[model samples]
Target chain A: MSFSLKKDKQGVVVVGVDGQLIVGNRQELKQKVLDTLESGGRKFVIDFTKTGYIDSSGLGVLVSLSKKIREQGGDLRLCGLNEDLQTLFELTKLDTLFAIARTPEEALAAF
Target chain B: MTQPQPPQPPQPLHVRRRATGGDTELSLDVPSDLDYVGRAVELIADQLPGGPLSPRRIRFNFRTAFAEALANAIAYGNHRDPGRVVHVRVEVAHDAVRVHVTDEGNGFDPKGVPDPTLPERLEREDGRGLFVLKSLMDQVAFNEKGNSVCLTLRAG
Candidate 1:
C-alpha cells in the first residue's frame, strides 16, 4: 500500500513496500520501478519487511519489472520477504527465477 | 396464520449470522472495479480471526486467495465493466470457510489455463492468479459455467 525509496551508498536503489500489494496498487509500484529503470538506475532492491500480503497481480508486476530490468543489462533483487511470502514465491515457482536476499544489505552487496 | 413477506432488493453488501451455530454468511455486490477488491477481501477475511483458523493461515492463505478471486472476477471475468456487478458470497462455519465468486461475463474452461510454472511461461505477467488461488486454498471448484468459482479452506 505504501512505498519508500532510497539510494544506498553503493548507488543501489532500495524500494520498501509497507502494505499488501494487490491489483489495486500494483500499477503504482510497477510504474515507480519502471520510471526508476528508465532514469538509468540499474541495481535495485525491493524490501518487503512491512508487507503482509501480495496477490498474483503483484507477483506479475515484479516479474515484468525484473524481466525489463534484466533485458536492459540491469538487475533487481528482493529482500525481507516474510515466511508467507517466501512460501508464496516457492509455490509459484518464481524462486528459481528471482535473486532473493535475506536483507537489503545483502541485496545491495550482491549487486 | 402466516403472512407473506415482500421481496427485498439486493444491497451492495449484506451480512447474515445464525446465532445458534455461530455461522456467518456475507454477500457483496460491488461494481467491477479493482479498487473494491482489496477492501472486500479484508471485510470477508476479518470474519475468520479468533475462530478455527490460525492467524497466519487467515492472514496469508485466505486473504491472498480471496483477493485473487475477486480480482479475477472484477478484471478478467467482468472486464472491468462498471455496469456489471461481481457477486461474492462467503460462508464461515465452525470447521471451514467457503467462498463463491461469480462474475457477469461469459465463463472459460479452467482446463485450458496453462501452467504458469512451466519453464516456458515463467515471465508472463498474467495467468498466475488461478494457480496461486488454487495453491493456497484447500479445495477449489468451478461451476459448469466457469464464471463462478468456489474456494474452500478447512481448519486443521
Candidate 2:
C-alpha cells in the first residue's frame, strides 16, 4: 500500500490511500497520520478513492487513529469508499462511528 | 523502443495441485509472516474457477476472507514466528471453494472470542479478523484445537 499526504488551502489534512490496506502496511498509514497529528494538524480527511481493499488490520489502525484524533479535540473524516469498502464498514458497524463523505471537498467542508 | 524484460522468477510458494473427480485440491506452505498473506490470497484466487458467483462478489468476498484467515494464522495463531509455517489446503469444487488454514500456536476457543460489534467493544483495535472472515464467508469452522480454521464460500 502507498499513502499521500497533503494539506488543503483551508488547512485540512487530506491523506490519500492507494492500493490495498492490509496487515503488511497498516502501520505506515498509522504512522503518517500520527505524525501529522503530532504536528498539530487537527482536521483531517482520509481519501479511499484509490484504495482497493482493507482487512481487519487496516480497520484497526483507522479506529485507533480516529480515537487518537478525537481525543485531541480534532476530527477525522473518510471519503471515496467504494461499494465493497462501504459494505465492510457497514458490516462492522463502523459507519456509525466515522464521518463519511463522498469526496474530499465534502469531507473538508464538514470540518 | 523499450528493452525486453527478463522472465520473472517464480514466487516462493509451494503449490501442489491434484484433481479428484470434478474437484481440485491445492496445498501450500508459507512462513508465518504477514507479508506473504496477500500473495497467498492472490495465488489461490487465480486457481478458483468461475462459477455462479459474480466476479465482483468472488473478488471481494474471497480476497477479504482469505486474507483475514492468513493474517490471523500468521499473527495470532503462529505468533509471527519466522520458523513456524502456516499450512493452507484448498478444495475447489464446482459449487464451492473451501480452505483450511493451520498454525503452530496453541489455539484458543473460538466461542471465547468477544463480539467486536458490541457497542462497548466497537473501538477496540484488535479481534475483528475472525468476525470479518465469518461475515464474508459462507461457512467458517474451527477445529477442536482451534489451531485450524476452515472457510468455505459457496457459488450462488
Candidate 3:
C-alpha cells in the first residue's frame, strides 16, 4: 500500500511500514530504503508499529537495506517490533544483530 | 451393455479423481477463520505411534514446520483468494508425514525463492519461510496442478 518516510534534522530516517509486508510490496520497500540512503540519510529507525505481519520477502528487503547502509559506515535500526516478529527474530537469531529500541527517540539516540 | 452404465448417478470431478496414492488423505476447510491454523502439529505428531519422547519431539518439529507453512498459506494465500478456503491433506506413511495445503490462488514459482542463511541476507524476513520449512521438514514440495503443496517430515 502506501509507505511513508519521514526524516528529521538528525539524519535518522523514520520509516513507517504500514499494512502487510508480503511478496508484492517487498521490492518497493527495498527501493524506498535505498532511495532514502541515496539522499544522504543513513542511520534509520524503521517503525514496525503498524506492520502487523511481514513474510520472508519483507524480511529480505530489510536485510538488503541493512547491508547497503552498513557499507556506508552507518547502521540501520529497528523499532516497535511486534511480539510475533520479535519471536521470529529471536528464533532466527537475527535479533542479536540489529540495534532495536522501544521507540524512535530511543533508536535515534542510540547512535 | 456399456451404455447401461451411463444410467448411474453423476460423480463430482474431485471424487472421480484418484487419490495421490502415497499414504493418508485428509480434507479441511477454512471459514472466516481468524487464528486460521490450529492443531496442525498434533495431527502430524499423532502419526508417530508411540515412544517415551516421540510425541514431544515430533510435536516440536511438526509444530514449527506446520505453523510456518500454515501462516504463509493463510496470510499470503488469503490475500490472493479473498474469502476463499484452504484445504489441507496429510499422508502418514512409514517414512514421513506428507502434508498438502491447497489454496485458491494461482501457483507460485518456488525455485525463484532466495536463500535466507546467506550472511548478507540474514536480516530479511522474506527468505525465512521456505528456509524454516526446509530446515524443519525432511522435504517440502509443491504441486499446483490442483493448487496443492505437499510437505514431508521424517518419522522415527
Best by TM-score: 1
lDDT, candidate 2, B1-156, per-residue tens: 999999865349867899899888889997888988878888877776677456886678888888898998898899999889999998888888888999998997889888898999999999898899888989999999999999898877
Clashing pairs in 2: none
**Each candidate: how many clashes?**
0, 0, 7
Cα lDDT listed for each candidate = 0.87, 0.88, 0.64
**Which residues of candidate 3, in runs, are more than 4 Å off?**
B1-127, B132-147, B150-156
TM-score, model 2 to reference: 0.90
The TM-score of the first chain in every model comes to 0.96, 0.97, 0.92
Report the C-alpha lDDT of model 1 over B1-156, residue by residue, as the tens digit.
Answer: 889988754335544444445877777787788988777877777655367678888888888998999999898899998789988888777898888999999988999999999989998998899999889999999999989999999975
Lowest lDDT 10-residue stretch of candidate 1 chain B:
B10-19
lDDT by residue (tens digit), candidate 2, A1-111: 399999999889999998778998888999999999999999999999998788999999999999999999999999999999999999999999999999888898887
Q: Which candidate would rank higher by TM-score, 2 or 3?
A: 2
Tell me the TM-score of each prediction against the true structure.
0.91, 0.90, 0.52
Model 1: share of true interface contacts reproduced = 0.88
lDDT of 1 at A95: 94
